[model samples]
Target: MTEETRNRALIVRGRYDLTVPERALIERGLLLADSLGKKEYACPILNARFVLMPAGTFMMGSPENEPDRCVDETLHQVTISKPFYMQTTEVTQGQWKKVMGGNPSCFKGDDNLPVEQVSWDDVQDFIERLNRQEGTVKYRLPTEAEWEYACRAGSTTAYCFGDDSGGLGEYAWYGDNSEDVTHPVGQKKPNAWGLYDMHGNVWEWVNDRYEDYSSGSVTDPESSSKGSDRVIRGGGWRYYAWSCRSAVRYNGPPDVRVNVLGFRLLSLSSHREIKSEVVTNEQVTSEKLKITSEKLKKLIRLGEEKGFITYDDLNDMLPSDVVSSDQIDDIIMFFIKKNIDIIDPDERETLIVNKPTTGETSRDRDFIAYNNGTVLDTRTNLMWAGEDNKFGINWADAESYCKNYRGGGYSDWRMPTLDELEELYKSENYENVIQITGWFVWASETRGSDAASFYFYDGSRDWYHQSNDSNGRALPVRSAK
Candidate 1:
């Protein structure tokens, strides 16, 4: 019998009830059986080849000890509940041209090269048109879960092959191998599922909105439909090998289109409805603003777009007469107050993810409502919940509640310090700028069994017993930076 056949036979009849480590070994072997196997489909119109992926349960996300793992990659079990056919490579320039009648890729050499410089929204448009022409809703982007499962190919290691990144050059066109440019797809080795360029080529967009993973096991898990950004997987030609790991994830606004971004296709067995979610885009600059303000607005726009502004950017946009080191420092401080960074630039660097989820905070006449469900003190760059914990709680529970708060997609909230709470009470204006519903707010400063509580009713502060629950409420605060 052929080697492929022998491996397939062994996997088909393999015992799965073995010890956890032994069963993992068997599954890894099973993943190897499908290498170059014949379960694939060819799209005649686009000349795209897709490999059939099997339904199986695998642990999603990275382990705590995994190197370069993001906090968002909460390790959990996930099942790709349905079998689907994934494009063997990212959609190529040729395929995109065949369907879209235009070549949008920055690298224009070969038709076989994976298309780059596309956005999630652009891919959605392509899919919609393709579906209309083919008369089927089967074509779509893979869910985040399915993308990881197929990318892992039953291996639990960091990369599809193993944890060692040294071997990645054989399977991916990464920064180390590609010489800082995208190359022809499928030139690298395929994963055990016969999928090519599933590691580094271009960062491929999946079909879900960006959200943190749930630590609990889930079936065919997908991201929440209510987020400002979409998840992109598989590091790009310009990215490091660790970023190209099976579990590494990053997100960008759906409308973001950069040279390192592209997407692959997945054909479903059953019909699914088209997703046409629209998100509002707030333009930074306005004509109504004065000329000087317009320049600063442009700075804001640049900062929000890429995360940080270059020193060159500031120099170019500033008034020509106001060109001194002290003047520039003052200008930088102004922008910093608005939570924008102006830093020294290395032209060699690429991809600035300024505010990953669309500057979540917006300034009003008085205060900025950080739509991430927090109120902001622009002076301190500290964010707080619009409302405090409605009921009274002991100091310990209050601390826990504040620390555990994940309001508005933020996770660093904690009990405010005594001075911080005092700042919230605008004693001069008789205003509670922080706007907590409760009268008394807990502060982190404590004296043995007593903790400080700020009273907004009269702008007074005092230490209370640690177990005090009478009119005591927890207020969560996090630094916007």
Candidate 2:
């Protein structure tokens, strides 16, 4: 009698044998999903179920003939060489509350419903805290290719059920049946691989910046490049069936939170126990060296307390400057080779740099230079351009210059931010610092109609006219991940 009741009645009593298109969809969908059926894993930290996805190569993006396909979804081949575990469903209200200690979902009262209204930035905090609780850096957001690879569950069809949109109701809760609000997760039938809510429920966030797909094949590709917006896949409860297609993509500002956006977790290889090795003290210490040793001890203690350093590898990790040396210097350099892949870029950018030390500072050491013509700042785990651009350029040109940089065996580089430039000031007075003396550097920050620039002379910062009127050098930086 009522509209809502009518929709529910139709859903329950609907009966139709497989159509020609439906049979094709089912066959294709089963290709990927039929094998990875419910390799279930429950995270001890959040107690949510995860499914192990296999490693294989597949076509990524969409074909030109795909109906409603966007121009950016250029078909290409992608190989996911490593297997990872992905959450069977989007993160639910209960899991978010357990890891983040709060539930921000607009659709409340159901603990099993997918959590929404969480921004990509907020998800970073959730991931960091979850890693700490689990005592391993294994959890992360899936890459765009990984997300699509799993969503397809092996099939290349538009909706993962083939090209037919009529049968989408059986596998997803989209606009037609969602009743304008999210329902509980896993209520509908799953895809061929037993993955529920892949087509609908909410827009799932992937760990990639918005970029057009390339035509060439790639192996274990990653998007380390920085951008203003991040990619979100899958459709939401309020979206039409076309938007729920497996190849569909959307992007939003990383800090923007909406009622329809949420994320799932991707678990990397299991944790390994770090083995400690004994190292004999190779450095001969004088009275002055003793004082430097005290400073090093204090720094190490602070690092341990801050959860940045583990005690297991204390001996294995020593100051980089102390390598192959018979004597030590005023500055001590501790090397921490983290699993860069597991760290999120947003969180990496937020890591606090230690203040300059009066007696012996960590910033006094030279960065680890790569054969590819880039330098690594072990202190903050950021890679920087070994040299500045010879000619000063406008802000717009500076951005383009950084993006086009091809040094260091990497392609994902961008101009440093204002705060990041300020952090570079800590390296002042160090002999090995990049020779940008007497020149101002352009930062990726805008002040009104003008851009911000940092003067290397006195470490002063100021705003200047737009790129047309003002000129400065651009120094590119990339995440070590």
Candidate 3:
């Protein structure tokens, strides 16, 4: 037979065990003979299956005698909490190419050999693409917690099989068994969990955002929400056997692709969703006040279609005098308290008059003292000095304005919603200086044809273009504290 066919024949035959039974040989023959239709057997050995691993919890990480133990791997209780099926051997090049479209492995060997030299990101993309073709989301990288738990396989020792590293040759292909190169997978004995090459093959990638471990027990602890690097686990054939210990942890960047990196898949178990408890009104009020204060200070933006107010007449109304830095700081603090509705009535009166040596500045006092005589949209102006102004614009133009328009020399701006605009109104004295003659438009966040606008005149809101034509004239724009 040709060398290529000879290798294929070798794979079909499989390895001999330390002990073999007569019944196993006969059963192999019967299965092959039947499929070959009474002809002499070309390949007598076939149909052998790898053993599957059963799931349970196990202690992860190293004990005191380990070569290099970091504080992050402090012995803490972890639970897998679910069963999953893992490959009996590391994924071979032939199987990888079949599932993924291309082969990027550095070492080229027999089709049955384990693929090597892939990165963590490359593996994730491969899994994502494979799931699309397979029509299932059942495949994913095992989380770091799952990897360690599986590697431990109920063993509390440094190595899953035992504490001594002398007999590693019997179960793994490490620095000694491997001649500075990866051999075909599954050439070694399986672990107690019936998994092969978990200790040494290629360093496998695990799904986790890396973080230091906490001292308490954690059930199925995934990584943190955000991190600079992702976690990788398991040692490779190129490293020392001690490095292949069950509890050893390592990490790498999510985007990195390397020759020594590869991954295995895990399937999630079915579970019920848990709901959180309700929040109190006091908490809600605190949150709403914070949001309101932030919204009030944000510069009002005009949409692209609506443009901005650029009249020289309006610009000329702004005062040329610069407010002292100390006074400006006090004014900002006053406005923040007012927006949060925390200022007392007595404090409010004293603030409006600019009286010196008070506990704190009032919103009305600061508004009149710092911005009372200024214009709204001037580069030289730092604040909008008006209580009531008619600002109107189409919904589309308003969004664009907030996104791009720079006011008070600041670029970050967003259009105010109806509720935000209404916060500026005084209900008790509505018919005097606050009333303006115009059908002005206020911005709303609602999108598409269901878009809405608020009317500043009566504090009433309705969908934009609900009663009027879709095409309307330029809407005025204004800003507030």
Candidate 4:
């Protein structure tokens, strides 16, 4: 084949190789064409934690007339370039421990408490350790500009909430709510975009060199090219609520460690260009089937006669015929059915035997249960029990929890809607299971209106019930494959 034709084939298949014919170009051993075409690449794994900040221009500082406005807090017009992710809250003791091997917070109650008394140098050490642990060198302290940009979250107000300090209790634990000490991070309200403790938790160390703002808009600004002290921002627990303004600034030596000091880390992400090829079944030839239809039919017949197909027989017969290029889907479906018989039958039979006797058995055995522990006619993989359970969560919260759940060999669990829940009820004795005390509270798919719930005690469908009053418990749970 011609070198050009071979190159074209390789390019179409998205494969990179060093082998190429010499006939296409090497005249007198001098290279003529660029044979190494660029191939698309992708990140097989990407994990970077970030908080989404909204986009807007805000007054960069507090007014001069405002109480406790430091000279640095000069009112100015600062236009945030765009929306971006910031740290969700100040770095917590738990997170610090993960990197530093010790907790430094004065008020160490929960691991979620904001880490304090850590110097800028100590924070850098923690960042280095984190980078090493994660096997990447992208992690570092956020530059001072990046810190202010994220803390502000596109808001120009003194606090992301507003100018009024009276409402500080809702968003932050300052001098009043702090009780002269730092509280756990994220206990108070979040900013507009759900970030917590961006204002008053502790002073956060940033990576910028301390310097005054320069004129004009800066894109991806960094700290001074050189400086002795690093920039610090955000107010501490002992400070007044207004001191926590988004535009506020402070600086400290890298070695200075105090009760109010802490730091957050940032990591630069590498972007990759991915080229994905869509291969249709039609494109695959019959010879590449891996398993032929005739073979599958023979196997199925043998299974029916002998009650099972031996692995030896399956291995001896090349699968190439059992799966045809055109019949790929059918072969896959057949194998799926066989696998289900091997894996799901026993569990299904157990569920069927345990099912309350009053319910009529449907011939279709493919149904699975939803979050309420009630059987759903459709396939789902969630398990649930009622209130006496630990983790109290509403439907939305429960749904979020279930989606993240990695249990029972299944990851596609979800909260069922009211209709889906009702379908599981034993219609004949709905009240029995629906109102069953201490068993399970049915999760309703309904929203904006009162949520519907069922009790497992009597197995009945009920509506307009208050989740708080029913004594029906919501069991935060996941699904089983």
Candidate 5:
């Protein structure tokens, strides 16, 4: 690829925002990935196809302005020092069955479907046997850095395709088009480097143990040598587009297996650069994505901390474009989803005065703590569990767990609704009344098949499906006697 062309391919924008040069470069890169001349190795035994990836540097994580970004996805530069081959698609049931002599996938039929429900330890065993058989060539899980590098495939967008999720249906098997189940591999458009299903299908396991990415530029970075959980990437068929972004990451214990968890292999071989694919001559500094107005982010945080924002606050924070004639509705809806209400300026001082402190002023608080694991709010006559279920769980399981709660030996314990969580957020003793050691807490509110969730740290509210277990916490509450 020409230095100029490689630079063009790294430029990212919304679906309708790309320039002619940008569109042309993206099309050309996909054409190259589809060409038969691209370096590819078809495994003799597993029947999996592998593509040779070029060594290059890329911005490793999401820029803060990207919509629905997580805190751990802090941006940094990473250089892959050596060229290597990654499986063209995730390992399929046929491939695992051929080597392991058994199929452990939850989604059955169509041997072409990426295998799921296999734990990281189970994959290690499969890799051990497969390596022993390959004899000359060996296979292992890619490191977290290697996985992101290969998934991005030179693009600097949320997904390998682009920033706008409207086009995600054509490129990945995610919640919108996945029918809540896994699908056959190689059905979507490949990335610039001839890789498939790098965004969604099943979460793929990486070799590195889970750790917060250390700050600073790195070359061939690897995770910690030891940890309780291993990193998982690419999201899954049940996940939405945001979760399938190239920079998105989640993790699980090595022995835990679920239908959404699976992995692909990295082929170990001597480096042989592919001329059409290599672009290492110059560093490709990606255009960091600038989506939502920066003012909106700050305002959103402010609203979360205060429980409500004022029209005056909006006047101060919203950019000209956000509060403009065309974008006024966008501004309103954005805060609505975030559970931030815009009130009159008159109410702002009242909200401020409501901020409770740990001084002598809070000695006579309405919420009373008990030696038993529960808290009683004398104001609302509601009793809440002192803590949560202590681990992440899916919406369905959380509902069941909350309804059957025996905390403080109470029989009527149940899940709190969005309104209840909002009330709790206003508590002067928030950290004391109901301790939240996790980010998200599940709520009783339901929208069709989806359920509401509250983010404790940022005061954001979201509704996810019953199946997505990531970041879900269960904190049961009931009417106090």
Candidate 6:
């Protein structure tokens, strides 16, 4: 084929080769990936299409000001240093059957629908079989960071489209539109990067262990073996729009498979750049040995002795070596938070005291009461509606109640966001102005037919099904101004 015709067809499929034609495309920088838009590759064995995602940097978590943001989504800079190929849509039942000789998807018949109900361990077996079939270990699940990077497709908004969940209907099959069933892939508009069904299809299993993020910059982070829980991203057909947000994260045991859980393959040829070599006596015995318990203890000791590791600095470190691979989440949290300037009680005290004040001394239990049935929390510079002696309301009605509230001489009162309610959890004990009991209170964050709520008793927050008809009190709040 002519070089011109060859280049045009090359854009459609990329096979691993060192041919003169491929070399010419490489010279033009089109063989490896497209600089703009998508680079498509059709897997010959499974006949599945994969899209090439360009390497770029993005804030990996939600901003503090983002509405309905979770506490674990601490905003941090992340760079995906290398471009990789990600499946355009989720792995389908047909593709799974082709590779593994069987499909485990709950929703069957449509060969194009994403394969679900496959555990992380089951996916590993699928990957192994696929690798053996392809004669290369090029297919694996994307790392948590890689998954988010690709999902965002260069957009930092809640959804790949933008902040407004209303636009999500055009791009996702979520709680409002999915009719509680999986649909064929690529039915909705693809993200800016031309990857389809990223927002809502099925929750895709990633290669990272779920953990709280540190507010610092990171590069090529792969939480491969950090914790026991394998990371899952994207919202399923049964979930709400909020769960499908780019920064939202959920995780489960590697062996646990649900009808809503599936995974897509990530292809990276640069895997050989880093190789695991057996530790020899000479290397391990060296004085400046890199891998050892002593070094880690020394680092921890330095953190205790002096505030040596800044929170930002700790965030930049690769999390793989921060804690033992076998460590449970509860124990690993101590080291992770300690390195990030959080585990220390003194640091916590300092954070609470050193806030921009609204002339509210937290110790005095000061609250500026208003005639319109609202109280100003001067410590947090937020206005809260006086708690009503009622049980609760549905999430929809609770949000409506906040918007219609004319209390505290404010017409703009609305249900507090999850982040805002989380702030009250700590300060509530000090200021008993609100009669908050053990009951959960509704937050503004919604996922499909579920909404996020905070419990004042243990200060825990979780998303509950709105259809369950469970009751949760509403605590409306607005800006102090």
Q: Candidate 1's residue-wise lDDT over 163-186, tens digit each?
A: 999999999988998888899889
Off by over 4 Å in 1: 1-38, 270-481
Candidate achieving higher lDDT, 1 or 5: 5
Name the best candidate (by lDDT).
Answer: 5
Winner of 3 and 5 under lDDT: 5
Candidate 6 local lDDT, 179-209, one digit each (tens): 9999989999998878888898799999878
Cα shift from native, residue 240, model 1 (Å): 0.9
Which candidate wins on TM-score? 2
Mind giving the per-residue lDDT tens digits that candidate 5 earns over 1-481?
1333223322311101212222232223212222223467776657788988777899999999999999999899999976778999999987775554346678887989999888999998778645433422257999999999999998999989899999988889999999999999989999998888898899999998888887899999988677789999998899888999999989899999999988999985331223334433332222211223345567777887977787778777655433223134334433443345566778777767674332111223777775344677787888887677554577766776666554444558788989888788777566765767667888888889988999877678988887776567778899987
Clashing pairs in 3: 117-259, 119-257, 302-401, 303-397, 303-398, 351-365, 352-365, 392-441, 392-475, 392-476
Give me the runs in candidate 3 sitting further than 4 Å from their true place.
1-55, 269-481
lDDT of each: 0.71, 0.67, 0.49, 0.51, 0.71, 0.66
lDDT per residue (tens digit) for residues 372-476 in model 2: 346677767788866665444667667766765544335587889888887777765422746563268888889787988888767789887764423477677
Worst 10 residues of 2 by lDDT: 326-335
Candidate 5 residue spans exceeding 4 A from truth: 1-38, 271-481
For each candidate in turn, the TM-score is 0.49, 0.51, 0.45, 0.45, 0.50, 0.50
Clashes of each: 2, 5, 10, 34, 0, 4
Predict model 4's lDDT versus the native: 0.51
Give RMSD to native, each candidate.
Answer: 26.2, 22.1, 29.4, 19.9, 23.2, 23.2
Q: Write the per-residue lDDT of candidate 3 for residues 378-468, one digit (tens) a residue.
A: 2212232222122233455445434332222233445555554454343323232233334644455565565656565577767665334
Q: Where's the lowest-lDDT run of ten residues in candidate 1?
A: 270-279
